[model samples]
Target: MKAISYSRYGGPEVLEFGERPDPKVGPDKVLVQVRAAAVNPVDWKAQAGYLDTIFDTVFPVIPGWDVSGVIVQPGVSVTEFSVGDEVMGYVREDVLCHGTFAEYVAAPVRTLARKPRNLGFEESAALPLAGLTAYQALHRALHLRSGDTLLVHAASGAVGSMAVQIARHLGARVIGASRDEGQDRVRELGAEPVPYGDGFTARVRELAPRGVDAALDTVGGQVLKDSAALLAPDGRLASIADGEVIALGGRYYWVRPDTDDLTALAGLVEGGALTVRVAASFPLERAADAQRANMEGGLHGKVVVTVDHDH
Candidate 1:
């Protein structure tokens, strides 16, 4: 099968497209005929080798984590899924576990969930990573509830966009922060948009004279520092950016995928409680271009890589 990979981590130039041996499935694993896969920040983190400490290093790695496809075959021990079943998953591709940059990739049954019936392969592909991060950080790590006010930093980006929508669904009054241009776009997603700039915190405090009930910090530099002070005494905070910021006194969040989280997200999409937006799409051979767009980071929504299969 033809796929894109990088023997070394650097810029998009490191990505090379070529044929690789088709992955064989292990007992408990399902071979998914990958219809589409979406790019996340982590994809470039691996491509650029920035996660040396957050994760173990491996060479010639394939970095995609969010995948949507049809089950072509399931292992002998896999009873949860069968051929022709449509699924999307937050797959944890262990280093060296070739990712969804190809025509097909093998995934453990535990990582699979029935794809949202309301979505297409492209939209389904966009959900697993960014959506889960938003759901977990808001409802799980941050302890949000209805009527509480919430602030989401970088709210126009992938994870941030999802965070704003998920927070609203959970009954929180969400304020989304992004650059001046992104404010309008995020505001359309049921959030009060704030500009992320000098004195951004002051702008946010003005939104909620009392204080925000919770915050999901997707852009965690000074943004998180201010979140600590903006929280309503019991207000919670969560971040996808990995770092020990205990000095700030807010909860630190690192996304962990589970079958239950995937199921809940699936339900939300089906029920029209959550929405997936696709900013661009590229064929598998153009995986390099897709990664380039994600790396540059100016697109309005998720960047997806479409793999070919007879769906």
Candidate 2:
């Protein structure tokens, strides 16, 4: 099968499009014909060796985790899904090879969920990782509840956008912080927009004088610090981007592949409580370009790589 891979850790320049061996299906896995895969910053960061200490890298690694595809074959022990099932997953394995940026992937059942019936493959592909991250952070780590006031940093980006919508669905009053250009989008996502940069904390304070009831930080460094300060006393805080959040009395979260969580996100999508915005897409062969596009930042939604089986 043709796939995008890199034999060594490097930038987009190291990625190559070529034929690679098809994955072997395990008893708890299914072989999926790839329809679309979403690019996350972690994809390129893992390719660049930033996560080497945390995840073992197999040489010539395929570099994607979020997928929306159809099941071509289910493993011998699989019973949850069968051939022809359309699914989406955050297909991160314990290791760093055999990823979704290929014609096919052998995805474990734990990572799979039925795709939202209301969305296309590209939008479904965009939902898993970012959606899971936001869902886990807001629902699990922060324990956000109705009537609570929540502040989401980077509120117009992929995960942050999901956070805003999910928080609103949970009946929270959302205050979203973004750049000036993304403020309108943040507001559209049901958050009161607060611009970042100078006076960011002050701006948030003006909206919630007692500080917010909870704060989610998608941007690290100074932004994380500001988020901590903006939290109301006894407020919950979580950060997917910075471990330093722990030092400031917040949980540092890493998204996990959980079928239950993905299913919940699909529920939100089908119910019209959640929507995915796809900012850009590239063919599978141009996955390196997709990675570069995601790395360039300033995108309000996901950058996706679509697979064409017709060719």
Candidate 3:
């Protein structure tokens, strides 16, 4: 099978596109013919070896986690899905290798969920990582409730955008912080937009003078500090980017694969409560280019790598 991999931890320059042996299917796993894969900042961070202490990395790693594909073979123990089922998943494991960047991936059943029928493969591919990050932060960490007020840092980015929509669906009045250029789009997603940087808390205060009931930080650094300061006395806080949030009485979360959570996201999409924004799509062979685009920044949504299995 054709795949892109890096034998050593480095930048996009180290990635190589070539033929590799197909993954062996195991019990409780399914062989998925990759239709599309989404690139996230973690993909590059992993490549650069930033997460080496956390996730076990085998050299010559296939670097991707989010995939939308069709099952070609279901493992003997897999019962929820059969061959020909359309699915999307966040396929992270304790170890890094055998990922969605290839023509196929052997995905564990715990990570797979039926893709939202309303969306295309590219859109579904973009959801698992970022969508789950946002969903888990709001629904689990923040414990967001209807009529509550929520503030999201970096609201226009991939995870932040989903946070805004999911918070709205949870019946929260959302305030999203982004650049001046992204404020309009942030507002369109049902959040009151505030520009980030100095005086950010003041801007948020102007919108919710009493302070927000919860805050989710996607951009780290002083943004988390500001979020901590602007939270209501009993407000909840969670950060995916900044571990320092834990020091400031907030929760730090790394997204985990849970098919139940993915199912909820799909239900939101099917019900017209959630939508995915795809910034660009590249062919599977151009995985490096896709990674480069993600690293370059200013993308309003996800960068997807599409596989041409028919060819």
Candidate 4:
């Protein structure tokens, strides 16, 4: 099968489009015919060897985690899904090897969930990783509840956008922070827009006045610092991007693969409570370009790579 891969850790220049051995279907995993795969910042970071200490990397690595595809075959031990099932998943594993950037992926059942009925392959592909990050941060880390006033940093980006919507669905009053250009979209997602940077904490405090009940930070550095300051005394805070959050008595989040959570997110999408926006879509051969776009930042939504099966 033709796919994009790199034999060594480097930038997008190392990525090459070529034929690779098809992934093997193991017990408890399913072989999916990839229709679309979404690019995450982590994809480029890992390719650049930024995560070498965290996750094992094998040579000729296929770099992607989020996928929306159809099952072509299920492993002997797989029972949750069968051939022909349409699914989306965050396919991260302990080791980086076979991945969703290819024409096919052997995905473990633990990460697989039925794709939201309301979405197409491209939209579904964008949800798993970013959506799960927001869902877990708000629901698990923050324990957000109805009537709570929540603050979400980088609210117009992929995860933050999802966080805003999910917080609203949980009945929280959301305050979403972004740059001046992003404020309009943040407000559209049901959050009171707060401009990011320098006086970010002050802006959020102005919106909540009494203080925010919880905060989720998707941008690191000063964003997390301000989020920590804006929290109410009893407020909870979590950051997926900021490792220093722990020093501030806040939780640092790394999204885990959870089929149950993915299923719940699908329910939200089906109910019109969540939406996945695609900033751009590239053909699989152009995976290098997709990663470049994600690294360039400032995207309102996900960048997806579409695989043409007949190619």
Best by lDDT: 2
Question: Candidates 3 and 4: which is better by TM-score?
Answer: 3
Q: Residue 305 of candidate 1: its Cα lDDT?
A: 95
Model 2 whole-model lDDT (C-alpha atoms): 0.95
Candidate ranking (lDDT, best to worst): 2, 3, 4, 1
Model 3: CA > 4 A from native: none
Whole-model Cα lDDT per candidate? 0.83, 0.95, 0.93, 0.91
| Candidate 1 TM-score versus the reference | 0.95
Q: Kindly list the per-residue Cα lDDT of model 1 for residues 197-276, writing each as its tens digit.
A: 68877888889878888888777777777887888877777777735455566677777767788889999988888899
Which ranges of candidate 4 are over 4 A from the true structure?
A: none
Screening candidate 1 with a backbone cut-off below 3 angstroms (N, C-alpha, C), the clashing residue pairs are none
Q: What would the per-residue lDDT of candidate 2 be over residues 244-294, giving only the tens digit for each residue?
A: 999999999999999999999999999999999999999999998899999
Q: Lowest-scoring 10 consecutive residues by lDDT in candidate 1? A: 242-251
List per-candidate RMSD values in Å: 1.7, 0.7, 0.8, 0.9
Candidate with more favorable, higher lDDT: 3 or 4: 3
TM-score of 4: 0.98
Compose the digit string of candidate 3's lDDT tens values, residues 1-311. 99999999899999999998899999989999999999999999999999989888888799899999999999998889998999999999889888889999999999999999999999999999999999988877888999999999889999999999999998899999999989998999999999976787788899999889999988888888888999889989899989999999999998999999999999999999999999999999999999999999898989999999787
Candidate 4 minimal-lDDT segment of 10 residues: 196-205
